[model samples]
Target: MLSETPRTRHRRIKENGRTDPADLHAVLAAGQVAHLGVVVDGHPMVVPTVYGHDHERIFLHGSVASRSLAGRGEVCVTVTVFDGLVLARSVFEHGVNYRSAMIYGVPRAVTDPGDLLYGLRLLTEHAAPGQWDYARRPSKKELAATRLLALPLAEASVKISDGFPDDGDGPDAALGLWAGRLPAVAAWGTPEPDPRLAAGIEPPPHIAGRAGAALHPRRPPPG
Candidate 1:
């Protein structure tokens, strides 16, 4: 349940609007890539890029040489997941059920040296858990050339849909047209080490495991 406030109600959409903060957080955490919508030079642009979330805020990184991050004012970010395909009796009524989160806020460049390093670590870990420790940390020069942006999740909305289609009553149902849901999921493939890797260099545990095992399946069990 959400606080009974005008702002919350304003963002609420019938059936689609999700008021549970935990649900929203889960969806955000489940995703690795986010599409950032921003107004650049008065033109709207949506860029797909990797992101990391630290419970309270979302971190987005870009090359310091990239203009998208250098000249941004306020940015609108959206993360989404397609759950399944909803097939209805009528073609016009067919649709896909999905979960999505929209965040609207101003992005401030991370300036503090300590916070910058921490944010970078969070970003790195978000993409590859345990990789931060396994790989060399960024040097001062590398850090200097990286741009990190943090956006608070305080003002955001989650929309989700599950189950089958909603076809009109009477004639639609009587027509006996097939109606059901086709589930969709994401899976990871087996780990393939670099050909140049030393013969003794084994895959790290984190790398050996699938990224989205819960959503998908592990490697076709070893023969």
Candidate 2:
């Protein structure tokens, strides 16, 4: 799992070098939105948008005229999810346990007709599994107006912080402050169908299946 240098290690975090690709991919898959950072006019700009991945490449889309997607050079993409808040006894040690991925690479515009359609499918399905098949396919005019970019997972990094904080054997512990992790999780609510739909319309299996599932702080499916 080691590619360049491990970033999850305590020393690497201290050195500010992240190098775990699996951690990076996991964070990316867990998140539907990403902050795309790129240089504009020699200044840094981060744009928030939706993203999708196929385990080997990450896909992003925007309007054909979007500045973030229309530039002539490389772009940096990052996806982050905060699993919980780590409230340590010491204020200095308080932090968040999170999963994040950073990708640095040049994005190639999707041109081939087949690849473009595939990328769009990936983007839609990433937002919600089984959604693409359930929804109407994009029309020719719609497809022509959209822009898609794909970045290979060749150069990426993941950093994750988990478990309780380092707060024992400190003066703050003696202060008798209540300190521990305040767990945060994302869960989906019951589906509310559109009022304009046909009277007999019922929740589709794909949409209805998400009930009681975690939206953030995602967990692996049961065996």
Best by lDDT: 2
Query: Compared with the true structure, what per-residue lDDT tens digits does model 2 show for residues 90-153?
Result: 7789888887777777889888889988898888877778988998998889888999989877
Predicted candidate 1 versus true structure: per-residue lDDT over 78-138, tens digit per residue = 8888778999998887889787778777887888889888888887876777898999988
Each candidate: what lDDT?
Answer: 0.75, 0.78
Off by over 4 Å in 1: 1-13, 215-223
Candidate 1 lands at a TM-score of: 0.87
Each candidate structure's TM-score, on Cα atoms with residue i matched to residue i, is 0.87, 0.88
With a 3 Å backbone cut-off (N, CA, C), the pairs that clash in candidate 1 are none
Best by TM-score: 2
Q: What would the TM-score be for candidate 2 when compared with the true structure? A: 0.88
Q: Candidate 2, which segments miss by more than 4 Å at Cα?
A: 5-20, 217-223
Model 1 worst lDDT window (10 residues): 214-223
